[model samples]
Target chain A: MKISELSECSGVSIASIKFYQREELLPEPERTSPNQAQYDTQHVDRLRLIRALVDVGGLSVATVRTVLAAAESDIPMDWAMGVAQRAIPGSVELPATTTRGVSEIDTITETLGWKVSPDNPGRGMAARVIDSYVQLDHEEILSVLPEYSRAAMIVAAADLASVGLQPSRMRMSETVVVGTVLGDSLFAGLRRMAQEDEARRRYAQVQS
Target chain B: MKISELSECSGVSIASIKFYQREELLPEPERTSPNQAQYDTQHVDRLRLIRALVDVGGLSVATVRTVLAAAESDIPMDWAMGVAQRAIPGSVELPATTTRGVSEIDTITETLGWKVSPDNPGRGMAARVIDSYVQLDHEEILSVLPEYSRAAMIVAAADLASVGLQPSRMRMSETVVVGTVLGDSLFAGLRRMAQEDEARRRYAQVQS
Candidate 1:
C-alpha cells in the first residue's frame, strides 16, 4: 500500500508517518521506485500502536520510540514491560529528601508481599505521590495506601490475564506494552466514574 | 510574609508565583507598597496545591484554575470533585463515532451497579480506550473490564475514605480535587510496580 493508503487505513496522517519514520519509530518501507514506497499490514498495525501510545497513553514521541523499541525487541516479556514502564514520564529518580516517602512505599510493597525491585521506576513514581501528600500536610490520606495496593494487585492480575489471552508471544509483547500504557488511562477513567457513583451512594439525598 | 517569602516557603520560583498571579491561579496578595505584596500561610498552601495540580496532576494552568475555583467554592464536595475530574485532560466529550464503545462502557458500569451519569467524562474517556482496542483488533483485552471495574470500585472507596479523613470541609474539598487528580498518577505508578511483581511471579525462572 501507498503511504496515503497507510494513512487512510491506519488513521494516521502522511506527515506523521514520515515523521515517525524519521524518528525511527517506524521502519522504512520497501521502495517501489525512485519516488514510491510500499507499506504493509504490519506498518498499519505499527502505526495504530504508535497512535495508541501517543494519543491515549499521552507519551512523548521520544518515549513512544523507546516503548516501540522495547516492544519490538526479542527480550523477555517482563524485561520489556519494565522498559515500557520506565519509559513513562514520571518514572524518574526522586530527590534525596523523599526518603520518608520512599520508605513508606517500601513498606506498602513489603506488606503486599510483592517482590518489586528496589529500582522499579514505579516505586519512585508512587513515592513521589506520597511525598506530595507529605508536602501538603495531608498525611491522613496515606491511610488508604493499603487499599490502593490491594486494588492495584487485583488490577495488575487482570492486566496480566488480558495479556495472557493474546494468541502469540508477539501479540502478548504488544499487549504488555500497549496494555501497560492504555490500562492506566482506562483505569483512571473508570475510577473517576466509580468515585462519582460511590459519592452518590454515600452522599446523594434521596429524591422525595 | 512577602511574595519572596511565599516563594521561599512554597519552593515555587518568584517568576512562577507572579505568573500564577497573572494567570489568576494564585490570588493577588495584600499590597504592602507599590512594588511589594504580603502573602500568608493561605498563600503558601494554595501554592502547594497549584504545584500539585500542575506538576503531579499534569493539569494545565487553565484546568488548575478551574479546580482551585471548584475547591474554593461553597459547593458540595462531590460536586466539586465532578468539576475537578471533568477539568482533567482526556475528560472531554468523545467523538460521535464512539457509540459502540460508549455502550460497552455503559454495560460495564451497569454490571457493576454503578450509577454513573451518561455525561460523565470518565465514561467517554474509558469508551475512547475501548474504541482504541476495537480499532486495533484487540477485543480480547476487553475481557478484563469486569476485573478493572471491580478494582476501580475498590480504589474509589479508598479515595473517598481518604477524602473523608480530612479534618474540614474545605480540606475535604481540596482532597477530593487533589486526590482525584493525583490518585490516577498514584495508582498508575503502583500498578506498574504490581505488574512487574506479577510478571516476575508468573514468568521468572527458578534461579539456581
Candidate 2:
C-alpha cells in the first residue's frame, strides 16, 4: 500500500502521518522507486495504534513516542507495560500534601498484600483523589474505595489475562501499551452506562 | 478574606482566580468598596471545586462553566449528574459507521435493563471502544464487558448512595456535577493501582 492508502485506512491525514514519521513515531517506509514508498500491514497497524493512543487515549505526543518505542522493543511484556503505565499523566496538586493520604493508600495496599513498587504513579494518583475528596469535605466518598479496589482487581485480572492471550509478541506489546491507555476510557464509558442503570433501578421506585 | 488570601489558600494564581470569576465559574465576591472585593469560605470552596474539575477532571473551561452552573441550579441530583456526564468527551473516531456496534451496546444495556437515554455519550463512547478493539482485531477484549458492567453497577450503587447522604441540596448538586467529572480520573487511578497489584500477584511466581 502507498502512504495515501495508509492515511485513508487509518483516518489519519497524510501530513500528520508524515509528521509522525518526522517525530520517529512511525518507521520509514520501503522505497519502491525514487518518488514512491510502499507501506505494509505493519505500518497500518502501527498508525492505528498511534491514533488510538493520541486521539482516544488522550496521550501526549511525547508520551506516545515513548510508548511506541516500548511497543517496538523486544522487551518483556511486564517491562513494556511498566514503561507505558509510567508514561501516563498523574493527578494535579492539592493543598497540604497529606502524609495521611499516603499512609491510607499504604494501608489498603498492605491489607490487600499486593506487591506494587513504591514509585508507581498510581499510588500518588490514588492518594491525590483522596485528597480531592477531603478538600471538598466529602470524605464519605472515600468509603467506596474498598469496593472500587475490588472492582479494579476484577477488571485488572481480566485485563492481564487478555494481554496474556494475545497470539504474538507484537500483539501482546500493542495490547500492553494501547490496551492500558484506552482501557481507562473503555471502562469509564461502561461504568457510566452501568451507573445509569443502577441509578434508575434504585431510585426510580422512590422518585415515582 | 481577600482575593490574595483566597489565591494562597486555594493555590490558584490570582490571575487565574480572576479569570474564573470572569468566566462565571466562580460567583462574584462581594465588593467591600470600589477598590476591593471580599471573598469568603464559599469562594474558597468554589475555587477548589473549579481546580478539581479543571486539573483532575480534565474538563474544558467551557464544560467546567456548564458544570458550575449545574451545581448552582436547584435541579434534581440525577438531572445535574446527567449534565455533567454528558459534558464528558468520548472516543474520537472509528472505521465504518457500524450500526452493529450501537446495537451491541443497546443489547447489553437492554439485557441489564439499564435505562440510559439514547443521547447519553456513554452509549457511543462504549461502542467506539468496542470498535477500536475490533479495528485492531482484538475483539476478544470486549468479552469482559459483562464483568466490567457488573463492576460498574457495584461502584454506581455506592456513588448514588453517597450522593443521597449529602447534607444539603447544594452539596448534593455539587457532588453530582463535580463527582461525575472527577470520578472518572479517581476510578482510573485506583484501577491502575489495583491492576499493578493483581498483575504482580498473578505473574510474580512465574517471573521470580
Candidate 3:
C-alpha cells in the first residue's frame, strides 16, 4: 500500500507518517523505483502503533524509540513484571492524612534512603508532604470523588500499557515519569488550589 | 528601606521583585518619594514568602494570588481552621486496580468524570495502562531500578520543591505552572513511543 492509504487507514496524517519513517518508528519502505516506495501490512501496523502512542498515549518520538528498543528484549518485560510485583517502579506512595507535623531530619534521611541534611528547611516540608500522603487513609482519598478519580487513573494506565509496558527504561522509564508529569501538572495544579482553600480556612481560624 | 534595598536584603533579583509587584504577590509598598518606593521589615518578610512560593513551591502567579488572598484574609486564624476542615471536600476514588481491556471510551469517560462509548477502538488499550500501574507492587518497582535510578525521582522532587517553597505562595504557584507545562509537553512525547513498543511486544509475544 501507498503511504497515503496507510495514513487514512491508520488515522495519522501523511506528513506524520513520513516523519516517523525518518525517525525509524516506521521502517523505510522498500523502493520499487526511484520515485516509488512500497509499504506492506507490517508498515501499516507499525504506523497504527506509532499513532496510538503519539496521538493517544502522548509519548515523544525519542522516548518512543528508546521504548521500542527496550521492549524488544524479553528481559525488559521480565524486569518490568518483576518490578510491578514489588512496586510501580519509580514511584513513592504517601497518605494524605497524618499528625506528623513534618518529618524530622531522621525521617527524611530514612525515607530518602540517604544521609540528607537534617536541618534542610525544605526537607521538613517534603517529608511532611510525603508523610501526609502516607498517613492519609486510603478511604480519605475515596472520600473525594470516590469513584471518578480511580476510574480515570486506571483507564489512563491501561492506555499506557497498551501503548507500551516495558518498564520505564524505555520511553522515559515507564509509569512514574508519566504519572509524575500528570500528577504534578494536572492533579498537583488542582491540589494547589485545594491547598489555598485550606490555607484560607487556616487564616480564618486564626482571625476568629 | 527602598525597593532596591529590599531586593538586596531578600536576595531576590530586582526584576523578580518587580514581577512580584506586578503580579500583586506583594502589597504596594509605601512610596518614599514621587519616583521611589519605601520598603519595610514587613515587605522584606513578604518578599521572602513570595520567593518561597514562586521559587520554592513552584506555583504560578495566579495561584499565588489566590493563596496569598487566603493567607491575608481579615478573618481570624481560628475561623480559618473551620475552613481547613472542609478543604478536602469530596472526591471520587475508584478501585485502585482496574479490570483489563476496558475500552478507550470508558477511559475518557472516567478521566473527564463523564460517560463515553465502549465501542471505540482505542479505549480498551487505554484502560490497560492504568490497570497495570495500579497492579504494580513496591518490590517490582525496586527491582527495575538501574543502579541509581531509585534515587533520581527522590532527588528531583526534593530539589523541585525547594526551588519554590520558601516564598510560599508565589514561588509555589510558579512551580506548579512549570509542572503543567512539562506535563503538556513531556508526557505527550513519551506516550507516543509507548504505543509502538506495546504493539511490537504483543506481536512478538504471540509469534514466539
Candidate 4:
C-alpha cells in the first residue's frame, strides 16, 4: 500500500512514516519507484509496535529498535526475561503475578533509607509486600502491571519533555538509570523534587 | 531576598524563576531595583507547592495553579473525596495513620470491599499489598504514591493521546462512573475483562 495509507493505518503521519523508515524502525519495503515504497501489514504491525514503544512507551528510536530486534529474534521468553533482568535484577524470576509488584519497591525504600537513615520505614513495607505476593493469583496480578509500566513511562516522558530536558545522551542516560535503579517511585520522586525545587525558586523570585 | 537569592534558596535557576513569575505561579515580588526583585519565605513556600503539584503531582502548571487557588478557597477534603468517588468510591478514606500494617491493609480491603465487592480478587491482592506497604512508615507509602500517581497520569495522558482512544477514555470514564455509582467491582470486572482481551490479542498476534 501507499505510504499515505501506511500512515493512516498506523495512525502515524506520512512524515513520521518516512522518518521511521530513515530510523529503520520501519523496514524498507520493496520499492516500485525511487520515491514510492511498497509497504505491508508487517510494516504496519512493526510500526504499530514502534509507535507503542516510542510514542506510548517513550523509548528512543534506537532503544525501540533494539527491543524490536529482540522481539523479532523469536528468542525464548527465557532470553527475553534474561535481557529484562538487567533493567530489573529479580524481575525475570518474579512470580509472573508479582513481577507486576516486585521487591523492587521495597528495595527502593531500603535504598533510600540506606541513603537517608539506617532504618527506613519503606524497608518494612517492602517486606509485607513480598509476603502478600505469596497469595496473589498470577493472571490477576500480572494484568495490572502493563497499566503500571505504561503509566510510569508515559508520565516520565511527559515530565522529561515538560522540563525541556535535553542533551539526549544525558537525558537518555538519566532515563535508563532512573528506570533501572530507582524502581518507578524514586524515579518519579527525584524528578518531582527537582522540578518543585526549581519551581519554588522561581515562584519566590516572582512573588513579593 | 533578591531573585538570585530566591533562586539559591529554591534551587531553581534564575530563568525559570523569571518564567514562573511571568506565569504567575508566583505573585509579583517587590521590585527593589531596576534590575532586581525581592521574594519572601511565603513566596518560597508557595513556589515549593507549585513545583510539587506540577512536577511531583504531574499536574499541568495551569492545573497546579487552580488546585492551589482551590486549596486557598478551602475546598473541603470531603468535596475532594466526593470527586474521587470514581477512582475509589466505596474505598475508605485513606487511613489517617502514617504507619500501617497487614491488619490495616486487611481492614481497608474489607471496608472497601463492603462497598465495592466482597469477593473481589483484587481486594484480596490489595490486602496482600499491605504486607509491602507495612514495611515502611507513612513517608515510604507516600513515596510510592508519586510513582503510582505518575503511572496513572501516564495512562490518562496516553489515552488522551492515541488518536481516538475515545473508547479507552470512555472505558476509563465508565470505570469512574461505575466506581461512583456502583461503587463496586462493576468497573473492576471490566478491567479484568480488558486484560483478558489484551492477553487474547497477544496470543493471536504472536501466532499470526
lDDT of 4 by residue, A1-208 (tens): 9988888877889888878888887788988999878989878766655554454335567766565565456654323322322322221222334442345443443442322121222223233333333332112222233443344334433333321232323223223223222233222222222222232332223333
Docking class of 1: medium
Task: Please provide, for model 1 over A1-208, each residue's C-alpha lDDT reduced to its tens digit, 9 standing for 90 to 100.
Answer: 9999999988888899999999988878999998999999989877877777676556889887777777677777777777766665546586667577888998888887888877887787788888888877778888888888889999999988888787765567667766876788789889989999998877676734
Pick by TM-score: which candidate is best? Answer: 1
**Sort by TM-score, best first: what order?**
1, 2, 3, 4
Better of 2 and 3 by DockQ: 2
Write candidate 3's Cα lDDT for B1-208 as tens digits. 8877888888888898888888777889898689988888877777765554554335557755665665457545423322222222122233344454243224334543422223221133333334443443212321221211112222223323332243543333333333322322222222222222332444334433
Q: Alpha carbon lDDT of residue A41, candidate 3?
A: 80
In model 3, which runs have C-alpha deviations exceeding 4 angstroms? A27-45, A52-63, A78-208, B1-4, B13-39, B53-67, B75-208
> What tens-digit string does per-residue lDDT give for candidate 4 at B1-208?
9878888888777898888878887889888888877799877765655554444334556655554454345344322222222122132223334334334434542442322223322333333334333321112332343433344343323222221221332222222222222211111222222222232332223532
lDDT of 3 by residue, A80-191 (tens): 3222222212222222544343333244235424322233222333333433323321112112221222222332344444335443343334443334333223332222
Per-prediction TM-score to the true structure, in the order listed: 0.79, 0.75, 0.42, 0.32
Identify the CAPRI category of the predicted complex in candidate 2: acceptable
Ranking by DockQ: 1, 2, 3, 4
True contacts kept of 2: 0.53
Report the lDDT tens digits of candidate 2 across residue range B127-201: 777777777677888777777887788778877888788876556656655566657767776677777776666
As for candidate 2, its clashing pairs are none
For residue A124, what is the lDDT in candidate 1? 79
Model 1 agreement with the true structure over B13-65: per-residue lDDT tens digits: 99999898899877778888998788998788788878777765678888787
lDDT value, residue A16 of candidate 2: 95
